[model samples]
Target: MSSKKSDSEKITIVIVGGGIGGLALLNALSTSIDPEKHTVVLVDARPSHMHLISALRLVVSDADDLLNKAVHPYGNHTFRNKFAGNGSFVHGSVTSVKFGDDGKGGELILDNGEIVAYDVLVLATGSSWPRPLGFPTESRSAIEEHIMARRAEFSAAKDILLVGGGSLGLELAGELKDIFPSKPVSIIHRERLLLNDTYPDKYRIAVQKAVEDRGVTVLLGDAITASNSSDVSTSQVPEGGFVTEQGKKLNPDLVVPTWGNRPNTSYLPSDLLSSTGHVKILPTFQLPAYPNVFAFGDIIDWKEQKGAAKAAFFHTPKVAKNVMVYLDLSERASTCDLMASRRSAKYTGCMEMIMITNGKSRGLGYFNILWGIIVGSWLITLLKAKTLMIGRIPSQTGFTPK
Candidate 1:
């Protein structure tokens, strides 16, 4: 299918990826952008928005319908109804995108041979995670099938070994122990501490304490042997038990590597990206070469740690404001008034604040302030652990969590 604007004067805004960053921008444009002057199209591979904040909880959860809450279908009236007549949500994986020779507009081709033309393009495609946390970029049913199978593995496994001491590894270990209390859960990390040096040592110790309090074993300053771990599909655990670099042998029924991630920039052009595959953008979030192009979320080469909170709060507003400013500059023949109203909308970065839920009831929080402020479990549970902020989906993206 192709996108055809009813009026030639209307600007076509094509946004790629329906993750947090994409949805936030969609909400901004759908509500404020002039329907008569511009059209919006959001393209995504999946049929629904996968809220992965609570993904660890879902895997260990006995609740069958928790998956429903995690994945909100695009067919929901709350999401589709919000769009103006010209705005829409298209489901397909973008194979490639090319801006027009004039650099004013461009067109992208999907895997299914559909072409989508746009006056302005936004690349919000986030990172690709492991199974359970991430699903196949196919239909909603396919994703559900994959998750259900992974859940079965979690249920049947006698013991689980998680590689990496990152936030996700810690959370997964906590969730497993929480649900299956008797099950042996262990985490192996290359670093001596539970997390990286990004946070204070005090905060990292607190995080380790929180995980250990739940009887989860953590082995620090160690890594899986190269013979066992491979470069391809790190998420795919080794078949049998493996030996650590320190020569410690482990035999867990399920092995999950929770380390390393790559941005979903394979479909993007190399010129617009850094050496690491992250999109290169100016402070305005627009591509330096393609002024009509913008990128956000995990795909952008930003200094901040990639998370839903940063994408929703910081990147969304800046891109939304700048997109409109660009549109006004494009539509108006006069430049003086538009230039006066223009704000570059710079994202300077925010305080390093982390709220990690160990289980349904216990967790840890930290804010990188003066020295550091370590919040208690009660606050963490109250804010994130209880529901993982799933209830806020409707208000944030106009889609009910279910």
Candidate 2:
């Protein structure tokens, strides 16, 4: 919708769930969406900037003073609002979508029974990955940031077990092993080999060699299921079994759920998606038969990726274009492929950087790009992650982190 319009007739675009994908889309859509012609409603059940996790490659000079939190600890609300700008971050769960004919209009029902009507709906409700907070993106930015720092605390520990030999687990375990060779690292996986679907033998070979060379023990192909039956639906607990199909138990100090995510699609109206709960998208990137409705990021299962794999929120321009097209701005809709972008991400998660802890003198780096499954060093564990951004998100009634 164009910015020029009467306030009363302005079309509303309702976005569900504020994660990497939702927030990124909101950031991109603000300029393109005319506030007069369209109102964007972004909903998530968390305090503003609550679940955005970050690891600073280098600490902000005055972050401690401005955020009122230690440089190593997570910042408070005062910090998050700065990150979100003036974006509308709601802290409420979307119950369901009120389905309508064609793709023109519908209502989104929240758990509070609050009904919101939208000219177009974008299901940017990303998936929930299993982690300490259940959903990796479900905690406050400060809290999750602190968790990354928590890994720093382990730099001096003597022995550690890294489970779930997939990319996440392997990268984390191997990185830690590389960064802290003083500590013995042991990896446990349910499968005989790291998931075959994720990589060819070469990458796995690289990961294995890197980790093993670093004195990390790689336990390949152990089948394990959820130890507890009730945990099957919740995101907090692992499937539970740490045993191989042969019944060998691989124990570790901490086990991270590396991959696997349940999409946030169930929050939409049942009729809005197929039985599987994924919004079926047409080739043009619009939700099947729904014009005002579109999807991107972890929600659309176009590729059979776990939520973690599809968590990149970089594909915002194309999604925004489709929204504009639905508003009658263009004769034809745009496509949501990465190839068209002038600047693009490599789209893989494994970079070799040094890790540091206990005030930066200590360091480790992975010679290989893949997590140090095989040939990593202790330096890989402490410093191989994120660079923080500049900003804070203000406190809002609905923008609470879950």
- Winning candidate number (TM-score): 1
TM-score between candidate 2 and the true structure: 0.64
Per-residue CA lDDT of model 1 for 310-362, tens digit only, reads 88888899899888877877776443433724655877787888888888788
Encode model 2's per-residue lDDT on 1-402: one tens digit a residue. Answer: 745555447676776755556655665666676554566666665543333332222211222232232122212322122222323445567776766775557887777777777777777777654543342233557554745544554543455554466654554553454346566777666665754444446545655665566677877765345563233223223334345556775443344444445666777656656665677776445665565677776666364443321344334556666666556532234433442232222222223322222112222222335453332334433332322121322222223232
Q: In model 1, what lDDT does residue 144 have? A: 76
Residue pairs in clash, model 1? none
| Runs off by more than 4 Å, candidate 2 | 1-6, 50-87, 133-163, 174-185, 225-243, 251-256, 269-277, 304-314, 329-402
Candidate 1 all-Cα RMSD: 3.4
Candidate models: Cα lDDT each? 0.79, 0.49
